[model samples]
Target: MNSSYANKSIAVLGAGESGEAAARLLHQEKAMVTILDTAEENKLRKKIDALGAEGIRVIADLAAEHESLHGHYDYVILSPGIDPAVPLVQHFIKRRIEMIGELELAFEMCKCPIIGITGTNGKTTTTQLVEKMLNACGVKTVASGNIGPAFSAKVNESSHLDVMTLEVSSFQLESIRRFHCQTSVWLGFAADHLDRYRSMDEYYVAKIRIFENQTEDDWAIVNYRDKLPALKAKKITFSAYVPDGDFSLREGVIHFRGERVLAMSETNLRGSHNAENLMATLGVGFVRGLSFAQMLPPLREYKPLPHRCEILRTVNGAEWVNDSKGTNPDSVEKALHSETRPVVLIAGGKDKGFEYDLLTDLVAARCRSVVVMGEMADRIEAIWKSRLPVANAGRSLEKAVELAHAAAQPGDVVLFSPGTSSFDMFKNYADRGNQFRALVQALPS
Candidate 1:
């Protein structure tokens, strides 16, 4: 695989990180490479210049028409963000051009042992935790894929690393025909990605294909609490309650197969949702032959990721938590259950066809006030307006925070767990969370 396509002509679709990096990698491999993007030529002129200097052709705007681009290239490397239904991409498919994801291209180039992590949630947290645990065990590894650098570029450059830890998204996994991994884990499932996939079954099947390419000799880890994962893998279950094959938090102590691993420690990550994330990380560590002693110590100092129930500051005795990563009803439900105190919930964004009815009941039971924002603010406000005091602050997050803070009592919690995406008001979840943090900090001390 490494040496077979050295001189083959390769066309890269999109000019984002994955596409650009893949084009660079393919060029470096001495493959005739060209990048085609829908981005304006004026906008990507400098990037095109850089690629031109690297001996790769760059076509932008209408100049990147599929017919002209696909006529000459042998293979097409797709950016994960592009929908296959797009006419240009569909044309390539019809022409029978060999299309693969950046991950698949990376797999061909990567020589190290791969450990891929996938789930509905907790992928980013679990990926980082796994990297830290392996590093503590004296293993040289870097976490990449959906969480970090483009996997193709990482494989092209990394020389001395012992392992590659990847957070594989369903979109990236969709085109992977033979992306193999030693250890793969499915955390849990719920309604998600209704916009990209035709049905939930299609979405889940894409995720499970991570294990579909593995052999019997390969290792697969799963959570016992999750029904789909056990059915998909040769199971090794971790729990928050009783001990099983590997790690469990029993009676306030962290243990692996009944051996005490770590004691109760100061980790800012609260709630049972995070507890499940910890269990999944520990399960991966145990499968890789890391000792319970070796794994637990590094994790003791581990910090919870920002925007996932991250505690911002104590404002007038009220605790504000940023959970901008909670982009669906299931995540919001978990965020609400994480605390016992009444919540002033800030939620609303671009709808991805997810139902908000479940959220209304959760808010009634746990939330004191619902502060709605973004484009779908009216829709969210309508659902909970009858049952609770709902405030509509339009599309501004700052105004939403101010309203939530005003509605929150001293002992209550103000949470930003928007049960939808940020595309309506911001670039992405990270940007949305950053703005929320900035607003929170600007409030009175």
Candidate 2:
């Protein structure tokens, strides 16, 4: 939270980008900071070197040998990806070592107002949309948090801004203490991170934590259908269903208090899911004094983010889409339903323990074929095999793309909508998506 950091001995776990940023900022604040990671030193050399250059001690690949050093730190700041359930991390927790994520640390330092967005999906798109709306209205804004630069960089920022639009995740929200946004948006929540959380209830709790430190003066933008418990902040709802909600979409027009704001055709963003995203952004914009005219241009002109059901190009009457950002069952399900053409779904990756049952009916209607690969290929194949024809697209990403392309007819769409993480075969989802883009681009016209 917003506390003095003079001479505070802090241990920043996981020497990744966020860890380095937190360590660097804390060091500037006169906190004695040390870096720690279980990954090999060489793999984390860039961050480790940056911290090392600052005269910070970095203990790489912390094993039993580093156990003795844990007791020296006053607090531990965890990076987003490193779960607190790590046996060593648990050791510190059970003993009452103060643990706060980098978001909480950054909140302590940022002087500007913040708009935080979190959900099961559409978070990045919605965050970008809100930032675009604010910036177009002549308000200084930056998209940070999980999307761009680490939040710690804002601590030393001398520039003035109206607000910072943040894409927060449940992982970052897990350890927040005093992190509160002037306007907080919970786009929607579902069962995700089952791999990290002990139960669905635990994961949902972390997401709702975004509103924890907010006061009654703060605004909470949420889904019209969300059954959230009573909160400290005032609620503003956006609905794709009920037209009576604060921000509603009906008959091709976006309604703010039952008055037409913008038409669905004007905003290039597609799918019912994105309609919900637009409604959330419009809700935040309404509270911030932005009119429909100001938000019109960006919503109309801004293209979809790469790998979020982006159409690469049409080749020989076939369209290949990259929805690599669809790394969950719900997102992939939405992607499949949004496609107008027959779908040859390039799906599966590292398992997140998601239930594919939700996608069953949609794929049965839209997807003609499912090409699967990666760690959870067999499991995913089994899920769709009963509904439609499922083929093992082999282990390589390129092979999977090739297989999907081969299976596609002239009028069909090859959708790379992997419903899980890409770590089993590639560095990350971006890498997987980039390779798919490259391979798709190379296909003969």
Q: TM-score of the candidate numbered 1? A: 0.93
The C-alpha stretches of model 2 lying farther than 4 A from their native spots are none
Q: Per-residue lDDT for 335-428 in model 2, tens only?
A: 8767788999988888888888777888989988889998888888887799898889667888887788778899998989998888888888
Candidate 1 backbone overlaps, count: 0
Weakest lDDT window of 10 consecutive positions for candidate 1: 226-235
Clashes of 2: 0
TM-score of each: 0.93, 0.95
lDDT of each: 0.82, 0.84
lDDT of 2: 0.84
Per-residue lDDT of candidate 1, residues 51-76 (tens digit): 99989888888443546554676889
